[model samples]
Target: MSKKNRQIVLASRPQGWVQESNFRLVETDVPALKDGEVLVKNIYLSLDPYMRGRMNATKSYASSVEIGQVMVGGTVGKVEASKNPQFREGDAVLGYFGWQEYGISDGKGLQKLPESKDIPLSTYLGVLGMPGLTAWVGLIEICQPKPGETVVVSAASGAVGSVVGQLAKAHDCCVVGIAGGPQKCNYIVQELGFDQAVDHRAGNLQEDLEKATPNGIDIDFENVGGEVMDTILGRLNTFARIALCGMVSQYNETQPAQFRNFGAMIASRVKMQGFLVGDYQHLWPQAQEELTSLLQAGKLKYRESIAHGVENAPKAFIGMLKGENFGKQLVKLSEE
Candidate 1:
């Protein structure tokens, strides 16, 4: 009998919050490889906040996922069978295999990963992959921190935000990370080495952020936008830079975020720029090289919350959006 491939598909567009009923898990036979095609058995599937935006019917930077389409995502997998000269069986590669146990690739958009036991294949989905690049581009390219400058990172305990805070510290800046709970806040400060951490759920965002940035924020790596952003904006020093990476706080909201500190941008002359990782693809190689170096030197720290099966991807994704994840969130579909 042929092996069955378990896959998750979009059943409905989310209304306000994403429910498990929004996704449908279906099974199909593992596909046979055609000429110039490779059979990829997915190992890890990434769950990110940006995916919540794609669930909407209204299109944003990327097109919305149509109902019944395989949910969009990045995956690290192994070549199970290959009929292509460019790829061989057992080769580990990275591709957009989405939320599936297996996928078919034509070798057109697949990136073969270098064999390294030092760095786990899973890190390629987190600190050394898109999230890391997003952090590097947002902080290095957009924020442009200088030594002694105060850099504040919202969602600081998350994959991208954690890297942002660490990179800021490496550049001799006073780094402050804003996360949801005390555990996350403590982890960022005590473990991840952020200079300070503010709990956004403590119901004292304004006062806590004010205390954390006594000198005022010179650079804001804005991730959780809503009130966290408003608090950061209100504390911006003259000519501060704001690297607007994400607004995970409002991704599932039916109503738009109410900005209470827009005037602060005018008063402080802040330079706020929003960026997407796709637009800066050219810089990915540079980000990968530098982040790997940081990791090798023990200067970078990372964590992950892994959901065991592909069937749990939707639940894991929903938890990540709610800030329940510690760092990078991934679904482990199969063993490496």
Candidate 2:
């Protein structure tokens, strides 16, 4: 019998919170590669909050995942067989191969990863990948963080937020991170070296955020929207910049979040820009270079919550959307 290829397909669109039933796993025969095609055995799958938005049948930067379609995701995989000269067997490649145990690529969008024992292949899916670029672009390009500014990043323990906090600190700014629980908050401050951390789940977000930003927030790297964002809005310094990234808090909400302090934006002359990382694709290589330097210098830290097997992708992805993942959420489909 042909090797079984396991895949996760979108079974249905989410209503409020995503259920496991929304995804359906199916098995199929691994197809033979055609000329100019490369067959990749997927190793790692990235689970990000943005995937939640894609599950909805709404217009966005990218097209929505249709029912019976393979769930969209970033994957790091090794080429098991290749008919394309651009890639060879044993070459590790990265691409939007979605949630599958195996993927066939024509080498059009598949990027061969440089051999590096120093950097784990998984890191390419996290700090050195989209999340890292998101952080770099938002802070350095949009926010233009300056020394002595007070930068507050919401969801500060996750992949993007964590990097934003660290990058802000590197620029000589005092960074205050807002995360869900005490453990995440402590990790940001203690391990990630943020100036302070505010636990948003403490039932006193406004008070705690005020306490953390005595100088007022000069920049807000917002990842979680709703009350956290509203609280940050209320604390903005004059001419503060807000890089409105993902709104994980409101992603699964049936009703939109009410922002009571939105008027503060106008009063404070804040400049808020909602951006997609794909828009800054040209800067990714440069961002990776700088991020890699920081990693080598021990100025940057990263963490991951990995789920084993492609079968668990739905569960892991749901957890990531709920802010249960400590850092970059990923699924290990196969060993490198």
Candidate 3:
């Protein structure tokens, strides 16, 4: 193992849109493992839109990252050294190790990841991981889409949304995706097998969504909560289920959001519920098992937008907030 560990820390808070200057990359010595501790060399660090919210001073599902602290994130790494009886050298593990080349843990939150040629390790941070779990919990557990139901997902080509769309499609539902561009929209429809896809950037969102879903939407998997959400809410069928995931569209905005169709919740009897994956940790293993089977059977697909180094993680994160990333935005910290 290298004696030095390079880490990306939050340098400052963002005033509005996140800037690269908000982060700083610094190198430090790798601390020796204490009793019952393991040293993990991070390979892939997930760059998510929620990390932008963590940069703020206010609180959310998790605590905010203070300035000078390593930015918080999910990581997949290999155990380089171990003092714990449960972990051995070269064992792959997943944990909240943040943006660093090295992480030390005593097996608190760490879970052993599978070592297999068939499934890539980076998947522990994406599809077969948190985003995939989010999709499962939101779609199957929360929304509970029935066959022949019309399901619409915002940020449809993104990591979590993509998984949600595919899961809905597998359930024999009519899946309509709302993405940002023609390319993403095309991929959502053709590549992911979504029934219909609407390009949210084309400026006629209402018309596009209306045309795509002739029947009123029954299951709304919301990822981008802004005008797209407003348009979807307006067309919700009675007793419609809405799984409120991340609101990527307003993550960078400094001001409070004013909802135009929030009343649609009552008027259309929409069941809009916001959720965090952390709330259902007990079900993650079950979710992963189902996802793995689907992936092996060639029924599910996942995409990754990778940044090559830890130093570039900030740029990748900022780009993700601006909707520049394609799928799961990840920083390739080390090679397998």
Candidate 4:
């Protein structure tokens, strides 16, 4: 591999919302593929909210990316060269290939994708991959919604939230989604079959939530932690289950914000649990199979907010943090 590879490296730890200066774009020689290794040219990169946590040098469920290291992320890439018999040139695979144009892997953590021209390769970074899997495990395993139950999801129009709401509807549950604006809320209820949607940006969130979830929430898929969480927590039914997937609202906070209504959890008997998708890796194959089937049958629908160039990734990520993205936030590096 004689070509040079360009990557976004962590230049500094963010004190709050990340700025472009925190990242440095650098060019370096592409490393050669050694024995049992493959050279992958990244086509698409996933820009998830969780990557914000990794940018900070703090202890968490996952290790933080060191300053000067390439910002870590999931990537879908095509093999450029391979020494491993299981992989060859032109084969597309998904792996933790970071924020780079190319990567060298030994194929240990790579998953070979089927050559299905019917589906867009970009879907692998969204509906058919991590976001989809997270939604599946959180809904089926954590929330365990039953027929006629009310299931509410925050960030309801996002990649994971959209899937969760659809899956809950498939299970005969009444799903309510909470998103940022009237447009996103409409997409959730009208396009995704959610029973209703509440705009968190509305002036009366608590009242809006009460109106939307008249029967009360039985399962709350927690995505944003802040005022929306406070309002939803107040409306939880007895024996409610909460799947704490993310807190994008609080991700950039320097200190933990106070939630005065958490006491409601006691009276509601709410069981709140936080989960990292990596902990449920064993079930990914099952999730992919089921989700893929849903997609093929036209039962599952997804949206992507794609930034066309790697050079624009920083702006896209910043936009996502500010609720600008309507679905899975992604950066497209190339058409390969």
Candidate 5:
């Protein structure tokens, strides 16, 4: 193990578009592992839309990252040194380790990565990790899709949205995916088995959605909340359910836009609920089993856009906010 650690720290808050100046890469001495603590070398770092909100000092579902602190993130890493009885040196684990080459943990909030011949280590950060868990909780617990029901999902080619669309199909629902470009739209329909897909970037977004879903939408797994949410809200059926997992479109807005049809919730009797994955942590084991089975059976599909090297993490994160990532955006910090 080395005597130093390198990390990306939050340099400042952004008003709209975050730039390179907002982050500063610095090196410092690695803290000695105390009793019951472990030192981990990060292998992969997850770049999520939620991190955008944390960059600002504001009230949100989670705490904001303070200036000069390591940018918060989930990491997959190998234990380099351990005084903890439960974790051994070289064991792979997953936890909220922030943006750094190495992290020191006291064993709390750490989970050992399970050995699976069919799954890659990266899956623990994508389809089999937080993104997958978010989709599972939103669709199964919030939306509760039924066979033959009409389902709509925004950002359908993304990590969470991709899983939501496929899971809806597994439940026999007619799934329609909304994405930004022709390539992603094609991937959703042709590769992921979505019944229909609409390119939200098209000039006639409302028209395309109406055509894709002839019948009213029954379950909406919303990820991008902007005009896409508005279009879907208009097509929602009576008693429709909306799982508000994320609002990637509004995350960068200085002042979030107000929904024009906010009053429609009363008329349609729709159930729109926002949720955090941590709220349903108790069901993780059950979700893991179900999602794993689906993956093993070739029913579940996922995509990943990875950037090599730690210095590229910020660029990859900004790209994800602009919808440039095809799937989960991850940064590979090192091979070990």
Candidate 6:
């Protein structure tokens, strides 16, 4: 076993957008495990836009990350040593192990992964994990998109949005995606099979969106806010539904999110609801089963952007906030 455990800790809170100076990487000796505890060597550290909200001085749905504490994140790791009866040395598990190379757990939230030859373990941190579940809840349950209806997704190339678009397609809905760049727009349409994709950065957002959805949007799986949300709101058909997921566009903003189409809700009779994945814990097992089945049937496609080491997590996280990542962003800590 290694003598030291490396960690990325929060050095300070961000005022607006996250900066690398807000994080610091340090090493400390791994302590001996006590009874009923297991030591996990982390393999991958999940990077997400929500972390930016956690860096704030104010609290929203969850508590904020305090200075000098290990930055919080989801991780997939191998059990290095176990004094717990339920786990063995080589077992793979998923847990909220934070931004550290190793974690000690008492078997509370840790889930032992089942043996699978088809899917990669890294996917458990992204597609088959929170983002996947988020997409499912938003598109399948909240949006309730019907066949032949137009379902438009924002931040359409990111982890949650990509999965949302694909799932809508699987349901036979006319899926359109909104992404940042031409390359990402191409990936969402060409590779992911979205019916149409509009590049938000192209300076023709309204024109392109109008061209894409001739009958107007029936369901809006919203991720990015700001101008994107404002535009999508304008195109909502009467009785349209919107699954308000994350608003990464306003996550790091100094000001609160503003929507210009508040009147559209009345004019279009749109039903918009904001949700958290944890709110529907009861359906998780069903979601996992169906998502895995979708994977086996080759109906779902996913991508991951990996940063090399734990030390690079801050940079990667900051990049993800700026829309620099193409898919699910993660930090590689150790080999499987």
TM-score of each: 0.98, 0.99, 0.97, 0.97, 0.97, 0.98
Report the backbone clash tally of model 2.
0
What do the candidate models score in CA lDDT, each in turn? 0.91, 0.92, 0.90, 0.90, 0.90, 0.91
Please give, for residues 226-277, the per-residue lDDT of candidate 3 as tens digits.
7888899888998999999988888877677667878989988888889998
| Candidate 1, superposed: residue stretches over 4 Å from native | none
lDDT per residue for candidate 1 within 112-206, as digits (tens), equals: 99889789998888999999999999999988899999999988999999999998888899999999888999999989899999998899989
Tell me the lDDT of candidate 3: 0.90
Candidate 2 global lDDT: 0.92
Candidate 6: C-alpha lDDT: 0.91
Model 2 ranges off by over 4 Å: none
lDDT of 1: 0.91
lDDT of 2 by residue, 284-319 (tens): 888999999998888889899999999999999888
Q: List the residue pairs that clash in candidate 3.
A: none
Instruction: Give a tens-digit lDDT track for model 6, residues 1-336.
Output: 747989999998877777899899999999999999999999998987778878887867889888999999999999999999999999999999899999999989999997688988888988899999999999988888789999999999999999999989989999999999999999999899999999999999999999999999999998988899999999999999999888888887878777787799999888989999999888888888888988888888888999988999999988998899989999999999
Worst 10 residues of 2 by lDDT: 115-124
Q: Which 10 successive residues of model 5 have the least lDDT summed?
A: 254-263
Tens digits of per-residue lDDT for model 5 on 1-336? 648788899999998888888998899999878899999999999998889999988898788999999999999999999999999999999988888889899999998997677988888998889999999999999988899999999999999999999988888999999999999999999999999999988889989999999998999999989888988888888899999988888887768677776666878899999999999999898988889999999988888899997778888888899999999999998895
- In the order shown, the candidates' Cα RMSDs to the true structure are 0.9, 0.8, 1.3, 1.2, 1.2, 1.1
RMSD of 5: 1.2
Ordered by lDDT, highest first, the candidates read 2, 1, 6, 5, 3, 4
Candidate 2: clashing pairs of residues: none
